[model samples]
Target: MQERGALLEVVVLHPRDVPGADEGGADRLFLVNDIESGGLSPEPGTVSRLCRETEIPVRVMLRLNDGLTTTGGELSRLVGLAEDYLSVGAEGLAFGFLDSDLEIDVEVCGYLADRLPGVPWTFHRAIDSALETDRAWRQVRHLPGVDAVLSAGSVRGLDAGCDELVERAAADPEVARLLMAGGGLRGEHVPWLARAGVRQFHVGSTVRPGGSWTKAYVDAAHVRSWRMLVDDAVDHELARRTTPYT
Candidate 1:
């Protein structure tokens, strides 16, 4: 099981946004490019700079395109990019794959994991888009180096997936430990998820002014508020769990 304190991971599109996220108590930074395309792999130089400069862990995205399926040629490029990110000291990676049948692509995922041995990675939100949720979860459970799975419990994001997330976490201990509740996550969702035993959370545009991904940058105060909110919720949940029933 994950440790008791809740973790706040923030998405960073550019180097400038790094300070606010780090200073705001973000536990990690999900580095990606082109947020409008659901996040593509960022330039290696950017990863190098951020990883070199920041104390916080940065998990670089390992996707070349918008879709989950990768071509052989794209896979080669991705492997090369993964090497570059690792050479620059990226703490970890965020990636996922799907077959044409819309199922989790274990072969592809395992291949990449083999090439990037010992690197901790996240199975990104592709699980929410899989044809069968149970099958998807089963496929990812044993994948090497996958320490976390980012999901909203649905492709449409938290408003549509919050109940499922809470229920699934409550039902499965492993799910609760590995799930990083995110994607359209809001302040209101934190307590419910915490009570359900989810210890990690992700935020993107929500930490930006007006929740705008393109117009504004992540504000430290906004990220700090989320940090405080998640910490408080987790503390309450921990207290409730430990207190003897009267």
Candidate 2:
């Protein structure tokens, strides 16, 4: 398989890194905190600072409820915070809400569209929590302003039957173009995903030596190493496709 355009994207899962972050060696920066238990709503300062200093476009993902459910007022507050993030410099936001049956709560998403400016928003893997993956996908993608849906495709993970994820991404060009493959993703598995026509990627462990709470900071070495592999893969994939054979 051959790569087309720039398909690789790196998601920054560390909070401390956000304050002093530079676009020194990344094609894109996904701003978030606490990858261990999904992610939390970013601190106001972290989001604001990244927007101020970085040239790289910022993708903000807010994990509502810190791993629980959010009430209407809570969602409203989150929207306010997201608006502040966009005003500062964020180019997009990632989030998801589930109904009782685990399907995407379209009502909540609609409220978000009303709250934030019309920037890009990705429905995070919370979609995978749906009891019905395909139905959940259908409902989420149809939400207004939802530009992308991030999923591992199946409950298993991105590595399993990834072809389905690529197909879903290619199915609706109008509603969704960014097909982010995540969950148990690593450098070694990128090629397989690329071959399956996946463009956007989400990775963390490969970027860190060992994620530790005691570190009190993002590991620069891990960031460089993970980014290098991603860039190399993007280059190799693109070269394979665009290089004309004599």
| Number of the top lDDT candidate | 1
Number of backbone collisions per candidate: 0, 0
lDDT of candidate 1 over 165-186, digit per residue (tens): 9999999989998999999999
Can you tell me which runs of candidate 1 are displaced by over 4 Å?
none
Residue 189, candidate 1: Cα error in Å is 0.9
Q: TM-scores of the models, in the given order?
A: 0.97, 0.79
Model 2 misplaced stretches (Cα beyond 4 Å): 1-4, 13-15, 18-24, 154-176, 213-216, 219-221, 235-246
Residue 52 error, candidate 1, Å: 2.7
Residue 86, candidate 2: how far off, in angstroms?
A: 1.7
Q: How well does candidate 2 match the true structure, expressed as C-alpha RMSD?
A: 3.7
C-alpha local distance difference test of each model: 0.93, 0.67
